[model samples]
Target: MGTPTPPPSAAKIRRTSSSGGSGSIILEKYQLGRLLGRGSFAKVYLARLLDNPSAPEVAIKVIDKAATVDAAMEPRIVREVSAMRRLHHHSNILTLHEVMATKTKIYLVMELAPGGELFAKLARSRRFSESTARRYFHQLISALRFCHQNGVFHRDIKPQNLLLDQNGLLKITDFGLSALSEQKIDGLVRTACGTPAYTAPEVISRKGYDAEKADAWSCGVLLYVFLVGSLPFDDGNLSNMYRAMHRRAFEFPDFVSKSAKIVIYRLLDPNPNTRLSLDELIKLSWFKKSFSQENLRSQGSDENPTGSEFLDSKQFKFMPRVNAFDLISMSSGLDLSGLFEEETTSSKEIRFTSKMEVAEIEEKVSKAGLEFQYRVERRKGGAMRLVKGRAVVVVEIWGVAPELWLVELRLVDGAAELGESQWGELRLGIGAIMAQ
Candidate 1:
């Protein structure tokens, strides 16, 4: 490690007083402290468990329910919960100890990694020596193998999402984009999602892509960055970058070793069919160097340790009060040729704020659909799917704040049947009902 990046300083960390009662107590348990990180809809705080002197400090991820609903990040949260719960057995995977919720917020109690994000470390160090990089890469591959063996696919794998503990052990975090085997339709995942630079070509193509192959491509990108200190396909233009990835346009620096070059080449192959699987990659000579069973076992036992007692205590129940919604707008009429087609041009989305209660909003939407002679069917998570002839629409209600709600109506399918004028009429009809 060169010129280590210091941990988040006191000046940067904001203090948040845990609401209600006195003296920064949350749910009569943990005491909130410095803010670890902040994002568009959430903030992470460092906290300590009350009355448990031996217990370690934890990171409390505080998500504003209203903000999440506004950003359509409900599905991402649900996927994270599901993925973490399933994959937390591995030592290299971040542990989600417990979950809590209030009327306005959702809390995820997670294991603390004081070293912070791996990306931050790489940024300061510029690049790692071959042995150092290989060690980290081994841990990543091991954790990823464990995930795949358990039928989980971490769709997003990058330095930013990887964390490091105080001992410098790598831990994979952020399962917001992960996909479970059960989510597969006809033995393939069709969702075209992930960081543009790291995403596989097949995924960008919108054709059904194998989850394992997509992940391998991302791993290749990460490996190149570890030794080269830069992205393989670095371009200002999104189209040019994507084109480079599709054509396997990248070269290794002269400093990269021969064995590392071979591994990277096999992994970065544009054709998914020819890409090396995680199992095959692990057996490569470069990966096998300085690697042993002892290196992996050094972290600790594989047995699941008993989790926080409070997480299981009867006094507390982890139920997410905020409803999770799928943000990805599915379009059957999408053109497969374009990798970055603008959804604004095809997807009709409308949002309005109201003082009405959730039930009142639901009723008004139903009444509006009835006026338009559209058959309304209730979908999971309180969404209404309306169909009439070949026109299809989805209406959803989200609570943004106390006494205020956001009503959203999106035209998801059959855009051809619902022309611009008809879609406008549908939106206006709903608006009229709510106005009453």
Candidate 2:
């Protein structure tokens, strides 16, 4: 895999020159206009690509190094960029065109969404009807499914992250905390991350939890917010919030649909193991019904409607292509491996390989019950090294014949083989293996 480009420095902060009474211009791409908004760590600007003058305008987000207090966040930012660059989907997710870095900031040129945030709309309306909520929920689920399938988990899923284009289409944005689903850590996400109102119980407990399941809980909170103008578990005190979440105590308004309520309950299950998986959510009756309706609506006369006709249409046109040369020029030396590091041995050796294949050993041990864990390393020559540890082979004699069984095979000390046990049946699967 290629390395990510370095972020910008603090000295590179440039003010945007106001054309009229507007603010200072930060980044200047060909034909792109001016800056729009500023966040804690980044700034967004309205810009147009030079190559496609007539193309729709895009919103470029620039992450200023000066604003990033935590040096640890730099890797996370790079990971977000790399992930976004690889993702290309249509259902309301922000389209990342190109990424560039100046001396002071990392710039992400993205498709400018015109409609603003769903938070603003929800605030204005105080809440949405069941049908409207269902529509938005369906869109959110679809986008999440795409991310999940690609091994991404948007740890922050709230109304604020949901941006709407001029055509009123909702798109997911702000992937700062997003990471691959398979990511593992010793403890829960330490950073008291995410909007407090949407945070899951496990997050507050400071216990390490699955990012995917945490995301699902947040989605459930978002659903509740869309349907009822407020969070399900909100109180004046932080302790109250934790208490409510711990008890899984949240009331559904009488107006909420039974089907929608069912979905929310499943998603908000306190036990991550019992929580509705993404696959299961996609198969729910509510999702099926809502998705079918959305498809019908899209196929009907509403097809190809402009931004003015629908509040959800994309207001600005996105540039078809981004200039990689420009990006490389702006970026300095970046450490790509810093963002994605696999588990290493005691010597801290980094293995870089494309594939690993494990061959089946030739030995038939009687099989009754089997449980084993092995560490498989991908060699440079496209081969796999299965480092097994201990194997417990047991033979039980029944009324008729003796049954052989393998209890637990702990692959820790070193590679070990079962003596006359079923080595052939102990086949290993190949893939990226993290020791930790």
Candidate 3:
């Protein structure tokens, strides 16, 4: 068979010209201008790709190595870049053009979304009208369905992550927490990681939760925030917020349309199994008639329209097709098997001398499912000095017959593993294991 056709290239917009000189050398090509925003570990700068002079202006995210405290975060960053590179959808999702790295920093060149964040817009407008909410919801669901169909779970889906183009189309960005489902894992993933306010109850409870379901819950929270201008569950304490989530203690505003309310209720269901599937969500009556055909056409006709316009249009339909090995190639370079190898050589063995610190232990265990109890041990003069060593957690899920599955979570100063009885408890994490 012939090679598949590549997706259409992104539209190019004129960039501001830069003067040539020694100081202008770096600024001439990338033209890294003023800092637009700063996050915990990174800073975003307005930039231009001089190689493609006519190409639209873009934003460059510079992740400082000195600022990143977590060693485990590097793999997650790589995974996000790889996933974005593989995705070629035409939604408002921010497109990653290239990844550049240096000894001190990593740079991500992305499309510059000028319309600002959806959160800012919401804050200014207080709450969106049903008609307005429906318009945005239609676009959001379409983008999310595209993500799910491609096996991508955008773990972070708050309004802050949503961007708007000049034409007022919403674009989803910030894939720091994104992961490909095909990545190898010890059995099931039990990590309780996500923004607490929008996190699903199952995730906060440390239950084995589906990433897709967790994403759906966040979407539900987003819809609620849009219509009501507040979180469904908020409290001074994290535990209290979690409790409220478990009890389903939240009220929908009276202004919400019946159809929108129905969809939100289904999306926020505690049971992942019962939550509205992306396919079903896209087919809902409200989504079907959310925006008029004229509105969609008008958005698409803009000179530099947001990709969401195309996604919301009938021309952009998501058709599910099964291809067994598509995800396999995406994770080719990641050697997870090495992580499972047991220490055979005497030099590889390390003796534990001290009990792991409770705070450090909690951080690692927090990522695991609550069904398992993790035990940490400090190794003497291994990776680091015993006094300043790291910790590792070995997790084994329970109830699976035959061979037991194991996962190791490493932290500074010690290591921990799931208790023997906890073996086989992870469903999705174990499902990620592939045959050699």
Candidate 4:
């Protein structure tokens, strides 16, 4: 048999430009660009394949191995990479192009969502109409169903992690907390991890729980947020919040349609055994209405029971895609989470822009090391570091545009002794050289 045509996504990956390059290039395949977002241990950047003008833009997630190891997050990171690689075929799931790593850093090249996070959109619009909410809900459920059938469970489900493409299609991301079937002990998952408001009560109870059922609970909470613009269960006190979740207590606004309410109610059922199964969910009257059959592909023989097309004549109404904005105060009801707190800049951090080539920046660091009696070393992933008797400084170069780069120098260790003078001299030295 002619090798069954590789999936469309697999074919695209095979056609990506081969890797080879130094300075601003990741493994010679992708050239890194402006920072898209940052977390405690990782930074996501916009990037594109080198030597291929028609290559689509992608996001490269650069994870600091040292930082993650220190925080005991190495296992979680590994699980995320494994799960995404196995589950990228679904329409609503984010696509991970490839993963590359060095001794100190791991890079995950993935499809970029130009439309940004769903959380940001909801923040701007307040809440969606019933029909609009149903559209997104249908897509999200379809993806969740696929994940369940494949034995991967996304423990965290929220608007912040649900992204949108240019056409407003929902894409699920951030699988760091996901659980695979092989990881289970005695056919059950015992880990208690997920966002407080979105976690299932069974998980919070510390008793082993069904991975798929916990994920189903989160899906319910997500749908509630999409329609109400707020969390279903939240409180200033952690105990109180968990208590509310145990009872599955939440009220729908007058605007929520009866059918939508029924769906949410079934999904939020505290008893995992009675929770709406994926097979049952799609058949629900609410989920079937106006759902675009073309958007959902049958996964197996049992997926479409009748093997007949959905007869709904109404076209799926497309919601307008909007720019993302910082989420403001969510004091609508029992809001207590500091989740949406605005980010603040620190006084010690310094940033500068330059037109110098990446190689020139490396040369400057070498000269600085000689002038200051420090050892200049090259990190496996194209980063540079200066070490003087354990006082270490890390330098990274990010390409923002052609001929323009943003270089960041951070003091990693022995800050008290090297405080201003050591790094200051190095910064001034590098800046002075760039000024030439």
The candidate scoring highest on lDDT is: 1
Candidate closest to the true structure, highest TM-score:
1
Model 1: per-residue lDDT, tens digit, 267-322?
A: 98889999998878876889879876555542554332212111211111121122
What TM-score would candidate 3 get against the native? Answer: 0.62
Clash totals in order: 0, 20, 29, 2
**Model 2 C-alpha lDDT per residue in residues 1-436, reported as the tens digit of each score:** 0111222322443333333112334344433356678767776777665444566677767676655545556757765775564344334568666565555556676777788889999999999987888778777766676565444577889888999876677789888777643244431334446777787777766567777678888888888888878888888798887787878888987988888899888888878889887667766778666455443232223322212212211121111122221233433434333322233221212222221111211011111122334343432212223344443221111110112111112121122344323343342211112111
Off by over 4 Å in 4: 1-23, 295-436
Supply the global lDDT for candidate 1: 0.69
| lDDT of prediction 2 | 0.54
Give the C-alpha miss distance for residue 130 in model 2, angstroms. 1.1
lDDT of 3 by residue, 1-436 (tens): 0111111221222122322111222322465767889977777887665566565677777766555535545666665775564343334577675554444555666777799999999999999987788788777766776565444677888999999877887888877677555431432346666788988888766456677778889989898898889998889898888778877788887777788888888988878889886666766777767455444432443322223433432122221111111111112223222222333111212111113333333333343333333333222111111111222332211111122222222221121243223323332222232210
TM-score of each: 0.65, 0.64, 0.62, 0.63
lDDT of each: 0.69, 0.54, 0.55, 0.66
Clashing pairs in 4: 20-28, 21-28
Task: Summarize candidate 4's per-residue lDDT along 127-207 as a digit string, tens digits.
Answer: 988888887877777677656644579999988999987778788999999997656665589988999889888897767
